[model samples]
Target: MKRRLALTAIALAVGAAASLSACSPGTASGTELVVTTFGGEWQKNFTDAVVKPFEKENNVTVKQVTLYSSDALAQLQAQKSSPQMDVVFFSGGQETVAAKDGLLAPIDPAALTNAPDLISQATAGLAGGRGPVVQITPMGLLYRTDKVSEPTSWNDPFNPDYRQHVAFTDLSNSYGTLGMLMINQARGGTIDNVTPGIDAIGQSTRAGDAIITKTSSDLQQAFAARDIWMAPYSQDYAETLRKAGQPVGFAIPKEGTTGSFITANLVAGRSNTELATKFIDYALSAGAQEKFVTGMAYSPVNTKAVVPADMQSKILAGPTLEKLVRFDPEQITGNAAAWQKQWQEQITR
Candidate 1:
């Protein structure tokens, strides 16, 4: 049964009284779990789809802390000696670094009943003992349909006709970097080399043909206010804009796109390991995955999760799904600092 606000308040009062009792020092701890999640609409949908159901089924209260992937990792490192969060959600492969630093617990595939239903891509992190990819958002081109014709390739942002109306996501954002890499690869640039992409975007910026946005909100505002007609962003965000009544569309440029995987990991050294793992398993289940697809337009990593026919055209599937380019996480992680520095010195400057 769903806990109503009044019941939750009364339970909190009762719990507080119980905590003060000498015999119940850890009573609440046993029934409470902390998990880190994203903010805004992401958190709302996640709570409705996964958290609430888990809380109801497990008869536990899930305390959700809003933190982006990188910030959440930093918090984990800070709390390593006395970990507070039980489970962590990561969308940018920060789990790779978290696992390396021993901040994340190794997930046992056998423990996850939904493990068998996951697609191969979702299991990519399994061999390395990282968390499973619960969901994915395809990084693609975001443009105003009413402002410009559909973009057929990654190179369309460079068209002179769209001068001063293109937006490039700064290197700090994962999707931004992925977008840059896609263009680079399309023009024959390797992961080891980002100069072609950097130079291309720099030229556009220097010529006043494009603008650089440091965050997703900046991109949204730019498009909303009609300052930018096009940008390389993820599909879910394109939906965000459309829902806001903006005339926008997402396109998978011919060069293909990359999948932004959102993973749920068990935090190391937490007493709630079993419950935390159960939550992770629940998130990977088809029902939870389908809820995310319907609520947030995210592509499911579970093959059994069905997308409605009308929604199928807006998400990654079929040929578009086939076009997913899996980049080396190591390449992105190892070179991120250098790329950021270069972006500042060569592009942002």
Candidate 2:
């Protein structure tokens, strides 16, 4: 029943497709639905878990506009009047921004049959109070299985044994910022008091024991080249690297991990509002969530979504992980810019 499209998943990879311009919004006949998604494995997993199924069920062709989370919001804002994008997937902080800018429409909880399946916290800080949380990829510690003893604590990245070979993402990025939050909580500092985490990193920075990475790709490259033995980062990304034959391993350090939520939002005034909402609901459904976790190694926000025995150890499954740290998107989004400023002035120095 799934009708194949020429471009099932587009890997525009951050402006690779600037040569292509945005199109007009979909019509009332539901002939096509324009949706924006992030590329790479996440896009592929989403296509399999949700997009293809939605297409088959609705009998409409989907035109995917692949954009990074940050770029997706920027595009939406740029094209607000013309409304080329029907729905979008955004990282938590971006979602908060989109919500604040009035870019997202309110999702009627009644329409989302799978709404009740979400874990209590997944609904936090959403643009309209409720919708499908696309995926929860928690930030933790990833280490070189061959060169570093698996890190057992959040502080392991700073341990002198791996001195000068530890990678830390610059705090400008979400995962990097979330990593700091994990360290903050682990070191007995509240969100308001992150100086403990800052001071800890300063010790390593001043001692010349850390390698600062400007982007996620930089961190990955550092790991691949064996220049960094450990980092506080995404578990799924680490899994992706390991599956690609990198000698990497991931763990939720004893202090626990924090996560960034990817959310699907219904655009305010696209003609396909109903279909768009259905797509959002589908992403959070048990079937879709299960697929994302099993197929993509992303954490599930749905309580009913079951993890296969084989993937149990890879997710936030145990009691310890069940208590993993979660950030307030509103608080984080509101303060992230200021934090980035401080990070530039203090940590990155």
Which number leads on lDDT? 1
Quick one: how many clashes does candidate 2 have? Answer: 0
Q: Write the per-residue lDDT of candidate 1 for residues 145-260, one digit (tens) a residue.
A: 99898899999999999999999999889889989999888778888999888889988998889999988888889997747899999999998998988899999887777878
Query: Whole-model lDDT for model 2 versus the true structure?
Result: 0.76
User: Runs in model 2 with CA error above 4 Å?
Assistant: 1-29, 124-127, 318-322
For every candidate structure, what is the RMSD over all alpha carbons to the true structure, in angstroms?
A: 7.2, 9.4
Strongest candidate by TM-score: 1
Candidate 2 pairs with clashing backbones: none
The TM-score measured for candidate 2 stands at 0.84
Residues 208-302, candidate 2: write the lDDT tens digits: 89867877678778887747888888978887877877788887777667787777887776778888888888788889889988888888878
Model 2 RMSD in Å is: 9.4
